[model samples]
Target: MSVDILIIEDEPGLSRMLATTLGAQGYAVSTAMRADEALARVAVDDPALILLDLGLPDGDGLQLLPLLKQRCQAQVLIVSARDQESDKIAALDAGAEDYLTKPFSVAELLARLRVAQRRRQEAAPVTQCYRAGELVVDLDQRQVSLAGEPVKLTPKEYQLLAILAQAGGRVVTHAQLLQAIWGRHHSDDTHYLRIYLRQLRQKLERDASEPRYLLTEPGVGYRLGDGTA
Candidate 1:
């Protein structure tokens, strides 16, 4: 499949330039100047990845992260002028797969895209089961175990857990997980994800109040335990 890339930038020139550059690199490109329009495009035709700018006309890019992730199931790479350390962390915390400051080189953007795509492609389905300390996930049977005991989960909860585990270590956004597990129709149900994540933490965490494996991305999404490559 041709990898479709959505560029969410308000600057017309920049959007065109990015589209042209990325297209030349053999990617299908779509551009949006506003968050609402971007969200609409993503909903109708989910892209494989997104290049998002935080300084939008209608809303903050961070606020739209979940929507983009959930509604479109795209890997978000924040492309913004905001260069604060807090901003980068916030974007990452919000479930963005990566971040790029403005005035970025097209080469760098493409390189990051390659890295993200590689990580996703290399993800092997959990064969029969996976164990991380006390947490045990049986992919085939759709069952979980904690501290040598079985733990029951709702269908959504099980799917969420499975997504995180399969990620290996990389951050999986709210949008990606939502679309993958619940389908595009249920992508906007952020509350459902939060509730189910909480349930999963309660079961797998030694102290669900202070989770170790099911780590929250705050405004973004959740990830598996902190172990990342």
Candidate 2:
């Protein structure tokens, strides 16, 4: 299937330019001029990835990140005019997988989208059984066990755990996890990630406070003790 990309940019010219460029590159493109509109668009058309502009007329794109994650399965990459280092860090910290400042090249945008698409395709299927440390998740069988004893996971909780296990040891960004487990449109729902992570720890961690297997990268993402890059 042609990869679908959503462009949430306020600039009409930029949005049209990007849509034209990506559409010419054989991608299915969708554009939204405001954060609220973007959310509404995501609800209707499930895009594979999103190109987000930080400063929106209706609301800040950063604030909408967690909401997007909870509402739609979208992997968001910030494409905005904001140039401050703090802006970049804040966006990344807020769960954006990548950041691209204004005046970016169309070629570069295409390349980055290619990378994101490839990564998504290359990802191992989130499946029934996953093992990391003493925790094992049998998703298909609806089973979980820690150190050989049966454990329980809510549907969302199990999904969160499965994603971390699939990530191996490499950090799975909050956005990535949100997109994987929740949906691309809901990439902004960090609250869901946090809540589910806590639940997973309670069930799988020897000490939920000082977890070993489900390690958090502070503001970035999560990783399993197993080996994933």
TM-score of each predicted structure versus truth: 0.58, 0.57
The Cα local distance difference test for each model comes to 0.80, 0.76
**What is candidate 2's lDDT per residue for 1-229, written digit by digit as tens?**
2239989988898889889988898888888998889888888888889999888999999998878878766667888888886677677656676788888888888777876776566456566366766667675776778789997667787777766655434457777788877789987889988888888777777778888777887666777764221
| Candidate that scores best on TM-score | 1
- Candidate 2 Cα errors over 4 Å, as ranges: 1-3, 124-229
lDDT of 1: 0.80
RMSD of each: 8.0, 8.5
The TM-score, computed over Cα atoms with residue i paired to residue i, of candidate 1 is 0.58
Task: Determine which window of 10 residues in candidate 2 has minimal summed lDDT.
Answer: 162-171
Pick the lDDT winner. Answer: 1
lDDT of 1 by residue, 1-229 (tens): 3348989999999999999998898889888999899888787667888999999999999999987777766778899999886787678767788888978887898899997776556555547566666777788888888777888888778888888877765667767787888788986778878888877777777677888888876765777774221
Clashes of each: 3, 24
**Which portions of model 1 show Cα errors greater than 4 Å?**
1-3, 123-229
